[model samples]
Target: MNNLEESKTFVASLESLEPMRDFVSQTGSNAGLNKKQIYGLCIAVDEIATNIILYGYQNSGIDNGLINIHTIFEKENFTVILEDSSTPFNPLETKIPDENELGLPLEERKIGGLGILMAKESVDEFRYEYKDGKNFNIFSVRPNDD
Candidate 1:
């Protein structure tokens, strides 16, 4: 199998969705990720990117900003890092649904808080931080050791 390490950065706009997906697909392929692993990585990244486009620069009315994506492929693990220079907001801070609360009516429990939760469950590790007026989210996954 071939292995590669690469990184790319793009403007934080709706148009960036395709490029982001392509980057992830390429990185996942190089890291020898199977279909399921690739899809999970792409979905998690999409959720975070969508959050940035929707809320990150909304307050300042900024048209374009940087959304940096860096990927590293080692012999055993894959790591993806996304960084954006917008308002400091970490999705990890949001509350996740509880199993007991699942029995409650959907409307009565909460309005919207599922994307991040799903992303969290799908990945092996999800971490976030805010620094220098930027939000950094790091996601890591280890393929099944067969």
Candidate 2:
């Protein structure tokens, strides 16, 4: 299938979040995603990118790291691939909060998992992989049906 694509590399730091989200938004828009879909795609990318910046880079004490974002516009979907070298983590492996857990009082809930859940739920598809010393987080979204 024919595909249109764009890619960018950013320093793995919180400062890069805005540009990262903007990249997703603009690409999603170009891919024919409506405002809400674009927003969700941005959130999916932002959440995963934030984790890569915080846990993968800063917390791991990597002095200088990078996040490479690649966007693909295919006939049936828009896909984003986020690659990083700081840590080999699969956010999808994290346990999602069950109904009982989500029903718990806000203060009693776990500190993690929610963001990843949101990131996963925000898009039509989400996948994670660690290969060749890099972490790959993939997010894809399809246009809403008429």
Candidate 3:
């Protein structure tokens, strides 16, 4: 099992995302994930963390917030837990349109929601929780090409 505790990363700007991605890529590799899994995990992490840093913290009058990431690898699952000290908002709560919006042209489709949808779709399991004044995004991949 791959387990990491208290792997805290502090970021006040988008500039920090590179290092975070590097860390996640390394962690995923160390956890024995395949290329597809590593790429999927990284993409999910990047999308969600970018939103948290850009909108939740930067635009919400917060100069900086701490982001702690924990990874858990079981026999058949790989999990990445992200905790952030931002305003209580759940990205998963975003409403996805019933229709297939991606098929629509950029001019015809409604704005926003594409990124969240991609992030959610990239993983086998994605959950969100807001507790103790912190926001949590749990992303996981199961056995077989998740």
Evaluated against the true structure, the overall lDDT of model 2 is 0.87
Model 1 CA lDDT for position 100: 68
Candidate 2 weakest ten by summed lDDT: 137-146
Clashing pairs in model 2? none
Cα-based lDDT for every prediction? 0.81, 0.87, 0.79
- After TM-score superposition, the amount by which residue 75's alpha carbon in candidate 1 deviates from its true location, in angstroms, is 4.1
**Estimated TM-score per prediction?**
0.85, 0.93, 0.88
What lDDT score is found at residue 102 in candidate 2?
90
How would you encode candidate 1's per-residue C-alpha lDDT over 7-30 as one tens digit per residue? 899888878888898899888877
On TM-score, the stronger of 1 and 3 is: 3
Q: What are the C-alpha RMSDs, in order, of all predicted structures?
A: 2.3, 1.6, 2.0
Task: Give the alpha carbon lDDT tens digit for every residue of 48-77 in model 3.
Answer: 888888888888888757677787777777
TM-score of candidate 1 on Cα atoms, chains taken together: 0.85
Candidate 1, after superposition: displacement of residue 109 in Å? Answer: 6.8
Q: Candidate 3's C-alpha lDDT?
A: 0.79
Better model by lDDT: candidate 2 vs candidate 3? 2
Candidate 2, 8-117: lDDT as tens digits:
99988889989999988888787778887788788888898899889988998998899999999888888899999977888988898888999999999886788898
- What is the full ranking by lDDT, best candidate first? 2, 1, 3
